[model samples]
Target: MPARRQAPVTSHIWASGGRHLWPSGEASALQSHERGHLVYAASGVLAVHTERGTSIVPANRIAWTPARFAHHHRAHGDTDMRIVFLAPSLARLVPAHPTVFLATDLAREVLLALTGPRNSDYDQSARSRLSRVLVGELREAQEQPLQLPEPHDDRLQALAQLLYENPGDNTSLAEHGRHIGASARTLSRLFHDELGMTFYEWRTQLRIYHALVLLAEGRDATQTAFACGWANPSHFIAAFTAIIGTTPGRYRTN
Candidate 1:
């Protein structure tokens, strides 16, 4: 198992937060909070893992975990992670479930200010105002398709683990079905019904998740592309950009 990153201490108040430095591959233990919170990676990538699936939080995005959702954090590189707990009043503004939102310039600045060293200088009212602004910015920001939802069906779960264990596996749904005792059409239907996505779409998300971890570990775009099962680097780049809002090469630099 990877070493654990320093977990955010539990806080039930509005705008309570601090920054933590995490080395590559570090992870936090699974836990839930009484209050909803936001996580931002000032640098590197943070993967927020829950039973539902994982949400990728790169520098340009922020991830929200609703109250009582069991989750863990994993650092993909030398990560500067910031956390901010929202009081119920502010939390009510966001979605009831986990989500990833684009970190606009204003939102990023607000987050940094809330978690930065100067946070201690603010009084409760000032902090509350800033927290509201942060939430407002997020309200205006676009929700990202960075989440990989897990499947609940037995065969789908088994198949998910198989592909997860080896993201480079390029086997078609037919081959997977043959190995797992289900027909290709059956598996396709299960994927759509249980996971709300096609097999290929889900596989692309899994591959991109793997690609992110590889790129965070300093792997180049071409190497990460092939390793994650993309035969053509151009396709990999396009897919990565579409989901992550940046090229793999560019993501590596920031």
Candidate 2:
């Protein structure tokens, strides 16, 4: 039998650019930095959480986060990704909010070059030139919206954890309330009070997050639908489209 290879950590750069991959449902730490970040999954799905909301980045899409934004990043499934750090001054050229951009070929190439090892030896002047080019490209890039609201209350946070742990579980509000030691009516109020959305809306977003991971791994829509708790493929497609403005087929394709 062939040897099973361990997942690679690849590289981590101190302040410029780096590339790495994360498997399904994997999450990074809540981190804040002085520099801004651009996170892209060249082939997979990524979900990033900031104070404002969660942004879902599909393949060929990049997520931009401004400086000093405390955020966490996650990958749904076998996500091939790149993370670029920009100086605070340069980041002002792009939008301050979390936005997704369509990664064109030239933009992709520049990103790749920056993260590649060949440019490591470049002098300060060369690095500055590359940074300027990247900022220019990002300024001209088209944006896509894939924002999902974050849960703020402890009760809602607990509920979200339960759903994440068991995506296949079809627990109702009453069941969840019982488990969490709250009444169904109380839970309903908490949803609005904390998450700014209803329980069903939050559940739909969670399911879509899981579906994005499976789709990125090249799973068929039907399989992904069943895996993420949808009764049927059509239902999954509809929900996914309603939230992401694109189908799983298009979301996965670069």
Candidate 3:
């Protein structure tokens, strides 16, 4: 709603297997709909952002966003995305929060079949059975650590916002604490107590989230490393691989 002016709109399209079969959105677009739906990429990468955190979705990973949750999707490279709406009952079967699942072969096939226009050829019973299988596959899907949880503390929130806006700022915790009216130790405790991670860990997670977006935009990994506050490209690579399970160079589209 409200014209969604700030970010590029996610064009609803799915291009799979070297064939662009339907309409699709462009890169870095943000949009949402009311109904609960599952988003899968047939090619390239997708990043889903919500209040909970951000999830990086490669082609083999499926992303789910529940109904009425205001989420934004960004495409990395020339991505082909598929959106399938779920009935209210079926939607309840999945987690209410945004989730990422490892797409199994069966799950992927059922998904493509369900989203494709040829599904019109299938009867209701056949369609219903397929839906059930898809949901079952989703239920067993392995979750990924693609999220950067949000903090509730006002001071922590301020610090997070600052880093989010300027990922390249390599400010020490003591320096930030002085500005935020807390000691470095105090904030470090909050990060662990509330967000379950150290200050540096959370910041690295946030930076990687940003790095995914930049890499999705076809930005070079070296450039993305510096842009996202990583002073050393090699170090950034190590951290990124540890979290994302792949190198940033491979994450980008040529």
Q: lDDT (CA) for every model shown?
A: 0.87, 0.76, 0.75
lDDT of 3: 0.75
Order of models, best TM-score first: 1, 3, 2
Per-residue lDDT of 83-117 in model 3, one digit per residue for the tens? 77776778889888888887889999988887676
Model 1 regions lying over 4 Å from their true place: 1-15
Model 3's number of clashes is: 5
Over 1-254, each residue of candidate 2 has an lDDT whose tens digit, in order, gives 01122343445574587877676556676788788888887666778888887888876667899888898877767776788888878898899887878776677777777777666776767777887887788788767666667676777778777887767567898999988888889989888876677888778877887777677677988998988888888988998887776787777664
lDDT per residue as tens, model 1, 1-254: 13355645333233487787887777788899999999999987889988878898988899999999999998887888899999999999999989999999999999998888788889989889999999999999879858889788899988998988899999989999999999999999998888889999999998988898888788999999999998999999999999988998888886
Best by lDDT: 1
lDDT of 1 at 87: 95
TM-score winner, 1 or 2: 1
Q: Is candidate 1 or candidate 2 better by lDDT?
A: 1
Model 3 residue 112 lDDT? 86
Instruction: Compute the lDDT of residue 142 as modeled in candidate 3.
Output: 72
Which residue pairs in candidate 1 collide? none
What overall lDDT, based on C-alpha atoms, would model 2 receive against the true structure? 0.76
